[model samples]
Target: MSETNDSLAEEKELLKSVENAPASKKISTYAKLSGPGWLQGAITLGGGSLGGSLYLGIIGGTELLWLQPLMMIFGILMLSVIGYVTLSTGKKPFQAINEHINPVLGWGWLIAAMLANLVWAMPQFSL
Candidate 1:
Protein backbone atom coordinates (compact mmCIF):
# COMPACT_ATOMS: atom_id res chain seq x y z
CA MET A 1 0.00 0.00 0.00
CA SER A 2 1.07 3.57 -0.54
CA GLU A 3 0.70 4.36 3.13
CA THR A 4 3.08 1.58 4.17
CA ASN A 5 5.54 2.56 1.46
CA ASP A 6 5.41 6.21 2.52
CA SER A 7 6.03 5.33 6.16
CA LEU A 8 8.91 3.04 5.26
CA ALA A 9 10.41 5.78 3.10
CA GLU A 10 10.04 8.31 5.89
CA GLU A 11 11.62 5.91 8.34
CA LYS A 12 14.53 5.29 5.98
CA GLU A 13 15.10 9.03 5.67
CA LEU A 14 15.00 9.46 9.44
CA LEU A 15 17.49 6.61 9.85
CA LYS A 16 19.82 8.11 7.25
CA SER A 17 19.73 11.53 8.93
CA VAL A 18 20.54 10.05 12.34
CA GLU A 19 23.24 7.73 11.09
CA ASN A 20 26.04 10.06 12.22
CA ALA A 21 24.17 11.84 15.01
CA PRO A 22 25.28 11.86 18.65
CA ALA A 23 24.86 8.56 20.49
CA SER A 24 21.95 9.85 22.52
CA LYS A 25 20.17 11.20 19.46
CA LYS A 26 20.81 8.00 17.53
CA ILE A 27 19.55 5.89 20.42
CA SER A 28 16.40 7.98 20.75
CA THR A 29 15.72 7.82 17.02
CA TYR A 30 16.22 4.07 17.00
CA ALA A 31 13.95 3.65 20.00
CA LYS A 32 11.28 5.74 18.34
CA LEU A 33 11.43 3.78 15.08
CA SER A 34 11.54 0.39 16.76
CA GLY A 35 7.76 0.12 17.06
CA PRO A 36 7.79 -3.69 16.78
CA GLY A 37 10.74 -4.26 19.13
CA TRP A 38 8.40 -5.08 21.99
CA LEU A 39 6.58 -7.64 19.84
CA GLN A 40 9.91 -9.23 18.90
CA GLY A 41 10.93 -9.29 22.56
CA ALA A 42 7.63 -10.90 23.46
CA ILE A 43 8.11 -13.60 20.85
CA THR A 44 11.73 -14.23 21.80
CA LEU A 45 11.20 -14.29 25.59
CA GLY A 46 7.71 -15.71 25.75
CA GLY A 47 6.41 -18.84 27.52
CA GLY A 48 8.75 -21.20 25.69
CA SER A 49 11.78 -19.17 26.74
CA LEU A 50 10.65 -19.13 30.39
CA GLY A 51 9.98 -22.88 30.37
CA GLY A 52 13.33 -23.62 28.74
CA SER A 53 15.22 -21.42 31.19
CA LEU A 54 13.51 -23.02 34.18
CA TYR A 55 14.15 -26.53 32.90
CA LEU A 56 17.79 -25.76 32.13
CA GLY A 57 18.31 -24.10 35.49
CA ILE A 58 16.96 -27.15 37.32
CA ILE A 59 19.01 -29.62 35.29
CA GLY A 60 22.32 -27.82 34.74
CA GLY A 61 22.38 -25.13 37.41
CA THR A 62 24.92 -22.41 36.59
CA GLU A 63 26.81 -24.70 34.27
CA LEU A 64 24.31 -23.97 31.47
CA LEU A 65 24.59 -20.20 31.69
CA TRP A 66 26.81 -20.20 28.59
CA LEU A 67 24.33 -22.27 26.61
CA GLN A 68 21.93 -19.40 26.06
CA PRO A 69 24.60 -17.07 24.68
CA LEU A 70 25.97 -19.86 22.50
CA MET A 71 22.52 -20.63 21.14
CA MET A 72 21.87 -16.92 20.55
CA ILE A 73 25.12 -16.66 18.58
CA PHE A 74 24.17 -19.65 16.44
CA GLY A 75 20.68 -18.24 15.93
CA ILE A 76 22.12 -14.96 14.76
CA LEU A 77 24.46 -16.73 12.38
CA MET A 78 21.60 -18.79 10.97
CA LEU A 79 19.46 -15.70 10.55
CA SER A 80 22.29 -13.94 8.77
CA VAL A 81 22.68 -16.90 6.45
CA ILE A 82 18.97 -16.92 5.70
CA GLY A 83 19.00 -13.20 5.07
CA TYR A 84 21.96 -13.54 2.71
CA VAL A 85 20.19 -16.31 0.82
CA THR A 86 17.04 -14.25 0.54
CA LEU A 87 19.00 -11.32 -0.83
CA SER A 88 20.87 -13.52 -3.29
CA THR A 89 17.86 -15.50 -4.45
CA GLY A 90 14.86 -13.69 -5.79
CA LYS A 91 12.89 -16.92 -5.52
CA LYS A 92 10.53 -17.54 -2.66
CA PRO A 93 11.08 -20.48 -0.31
CA PHE A 94 7.44 -21.52 -0.12
CA GLN A 95 7.31 -21.90 -3.87
CA ALA A 96 9.74 -24.76 -3.56
CA ILE A 97 7.70 -26.19 -0.72
CA ASN A 98 4.54 -26.10 -2.78
CA GLU A 99 6.29 -27.57 -5.82
CA HIS A 100 7.49 -30.52 -3.78
CA ILE A 101 11.12 -31.31 -3.07
CA ASN A 102 9.68 -34.21 -5.00
CA PRO A 103 5.97 -34.58 -4.21
CA VAL A 104 6.35 -36.98 -1.27
CA LEU A 105 8.87 -34.87 0.69
CA GLY A 106 6.99 -31.73 -0.16
CA TRP A 107 3.80 -33.20 1.24
CA GLY A 108 5.70 -34.22 4.37
CA TRP A 109 7.12 -30.73 4.81
CA LEU A 110 3.72 -29.16 4.20
CA ILE A 111 2.08 -31.46 6.71
CA ALA A 112 4.78 -30.72 9.28
CA ALA A 113 4.36 -27.00 8.74
CA MET A 114 0.60 -27.30 9.13
CA LEU A 115 0.99 -29.27 12.37
CA ALA A 116 3.50 -26.74 13.70
CA ASN A 117 1.09 -23.90 12.99
CA LEU A 118 -1.71 -25.82 14.70
CA VAL A 119 0.43 -26.38 17.82
CA TRP A 120 1.61 -22.76 17.78
CA ALA A 121 -1.96 -21.50 17.72
CA MET A 122 -3.02 -23.67 20.69
CA PRO A 123 -1.89 -21.16 23.32
CA GLN A 124 -4.04 -18.42 21.82
CA PHE A 125 -7.20 -20.42 22.57
CA SER A 126 -6.56 -19.91 26.31
CA LEU A 127 -7.07 -16.19 25.83
Candidate 2:
Protein backbone atom coordinates (compact mmCIF):
# COMPACT_ATOMS: atom_id res chain seq x y z
CA MET A 1 0.00 0.00 0.00
CA SER A 2 2.82 2.43 0.83
CA GLU A 3 4.65 1.61 -2.42
CA THR A 4 1.48 2.22 -4.45
CA ASN A 5 0.94 5.59 -2.77
CA ASP A 6 4.52 6.62 -3.45
CA SER A 7 4.25 5.66 -7.12
CA LEU A 8 1.00 7.62 -7.49
CA ALA A 9 2.58 10.68 -5.92
CA GLU A 10 5.58 10.43 -8.27
CA GLU A 11 3.31 10.13 -11.27
CA LYS A 12 1.32 13.19 -10.22
CA GLU A 13 4.49 15.21 -9.80
CA LEU A 14 5.70 14.15 -13.23
CA LEU A 15 2.41 15.19 -14.77
CA LYS A 16 2.58 18.56 -13.04
CA SER A 17 6.13 19.12 -14.27
CA VAL A 18 5.10 18.31 -17.82
CA GLU A 19 2.06 20.58 -17.66
CA ASN A 20 4.24 23.44 -16.45
CA ALA A 21 6.95 22.92 -19.07
CA PRO A 22 7.78 25.88 -21.36
CA ALA A 23 6.73 25.72 -24.99
CA SER A 24 10.23 26.33 -26.35
CA LYS A 25 11.60 23.51 -24.25
CA LYS A 26 9.14 21.06 -25.83
CA ILE A 27 10.82 20.35 -29.15
CA SER A 28 8.96 17.08 -29.53
CA THR A 29 5.65 18.94 -29.45
CA TYR A 30 6.57 20.96 -32.53
CA ALA A 31 8.08 17.94 -34.21
CA LYS A 32 4.96 15.83 -33.70
CA LEU A 33 2.71 18.60 -34.99
CA SER A 34 4.85 19.39 -38.05
CA GLY A 35 5.68 15.78 -38.91
CA PRO A 36 2.75 15.31 -41.29
CA GLY A 37 3.73 18.29 -43.43
CA TRP A 38 7.34 17.14 -43.56
CA LEU A 39 6.23 13.65 -44.55
CA GLN A 40 4.00 15.00 -47.31
CA GLY A 41 6.81 17.12 -48.69
CA ALA A 42 9.16 14.14 -48.68
CA ILE A 43 6.64 11.87 -50.35
CA THR A 44 6.05 14.43 -53.08
CA LEU A 45 9.53 13.81 -54.49
CA GLY A 46 8.30 11.01 -56.70
CA GLY A 47 8.31 10.12 -60.38
CA GLY A 48 8.19 13.78 -61.41
CA SER A 49 11.47 14.59 -59.68
CA LEU A 50 13.11 11.43 -61.03
CA GLY A 51 12.01 12.25 -64.56
CA GLY A 52 13.14 15.82 -64.22
CA SER A 53 16.57 14.76 -62.97
CA LEU A 54 17.00 12.21 -65.75
CA TYR A 55 16.06 14.76 -68.43
CA LEU A 56 18.24 17.43 -66.90
CA GLY A 57 21.21 15.07 -66.69
CA ILE A 58 20.83 13.80 -70.23
CA ILE A 59 20.20 17.17 -71.89
CA GLY A 60 22.27 19.55 -69.78
CA GLY A 61 24.77 17.02 -68.36
CA THR A 62 26.89 18.09 -65.39
CA GLU A 63 26.74 21.68 -66.57
CA LEU A 64 23.10 21.98 -65.39
CA LEU A 65 23.72 20.62 -61.90
CA TRP A 66 23.41 24.21 -60.70
CA LEU A 67 19.85 24.41 -62.11
CA GLN A 68 18.59 21.50 -59.98
CA PRO A 69 19.86 23.14 -56.80
CA LEU A 70 18.32 26.45 -57.83
CA MET A 71 14.98 24.79 -58.51
CA MET A 72 15.12 22.99 -55.15
CA ILE A 73 15.81 26.30 -53.38
CA PHE A 74 12.80 27.85 -55.08
CA GLY A 75 10.65 24.84 -54.17
CA ILE A 76 11.72 25.13 -50.53
CA LEU A 77 10.93 28.83 -50.55
CA MET A 78 7.48 28.18 -51.98
CA LEU A 79 6.73 25.45 -49.42
CA SER A 80 7.88 27.78 -46.62
CA VAL A 81 5.47 30.45 -47.81
CA ILE A 82 2.61 27.96 -48.06
CA GLY A 83 3.38 26.60 -44.58
CA TYR A 84 3.53 30.08 -43.09
CA VAL A 85 0.24 31.09 -44.60
CA THR A 86 -1.47 27.86 -43.56
CA LEU A 87 -0.12 27.85 -40.01
CA SER A 88 -0.54 31.58 -39.32
CA THR A 89 -4.08 31.82 -40.58
CA GLY A 90 -5.16 28.31 -39.50
CA LYS A 91 -6.58 27.88 -42.98
CA LYS A 92 -6.09 25.38 -45.77
CA PRO A 93 -3.68 26.61 -48.44
CA PHE A 94 -6.08 26.53 -51.37
CA GLN A 95 -8.81 28.35 -49.45
CA ALA A 96 -6.35 30.89 -48.08
CA ILE A 97 -4.90 31.48 -51.51
CA ASN A 98 -8.31 31.94 -53.02
CA GLU A 99 -9.49 34.26 -50.25
CA HIS A 100 -6.40 36.42 -49.79
CA ILE A 101 -4.98 36.27 -53.29
CA ASN A 102 -7.05 35.51 -56.39
CA PRO A 103 -9.48 32.67 -56.78
CA VAL A 104 -8.52 32.23 -60.42
CA LEU A 105 -4.89 31.92 -59.49
CA GLY A 106 -5.71 29.37 -56.82
CA TRP A 107 -7.78 27.29 -59.19
CA GLY A 108 -5.10 27.58 -61.81
CA TRP A 109 -2.53 26.30 -59.34
CA LEU A 110 -4.74 23.31 -58.45
CA ILE A 111 -5.29 22.44 -62.10
CA ALA A 112 -1.63 22.74 -62.90
CA ALA A 113 -0.69 20.54 -59.93
CA MET A 114 -3.20 17.90 -60.98
CA LEU A 115 -1.95 17.93 -64.56
CA ALA A 116 1.65 17.70 -63.47
CA ASN A 117 0.90 14.75 -61.19
CA LEU A 118 -0.89 12.96 -64.01
CA VAL A 119 1.94 13.64 -66.42
CA TRP A 120 4.52 12.40 -63.95
CA ALA A 121 2.55 9.33 -62.86
CA MET A 122 1.82 8.22 -66.41
CA PRO A 123 5.43 7.38 -67.23
CA GLN A 124 5.90 5.56 -63.95
CA PHE A 125 2.75 3.50 -64.45
CA SER A 126 3.67 2.71 -68.04
CA LEU A 127 7.00 1.34 -66.88
The number of the candidate with the highest TM-score is 2
Model 1 regions lying over 4 Å from their true place: 1-12, 31-38, 91-127
Model 2: how far residue 50 lies from native, Å: 3.0
Residues 1-127, candidate 1, lDDT per residue (tens digit)? 5996798899999999998999999999988987886686565555666666678889999999899889779757754554455445544544543453355655665686578446543444444
lDDT of 2: 0.74
Root-mean-square deviation of each candidate, in angstroms?
A: 5.3, 10.1
lDDT of 2 by residue, 24-118 (tens): 64555546545488767655676667887899799999999898789779878877877787766668999988888789977987897789677
Q: Cα deviation of 92 in candidate 1 (Å)?
A: 3.6
Per-candidate count of clashing residue pairs (backbone under 3 Å): 0, 0
Q: Of the candidates shown, which would achieve the greatest lDDT relative to the real structure?
A: 2
For model 1 the TM-score comes to 0.54
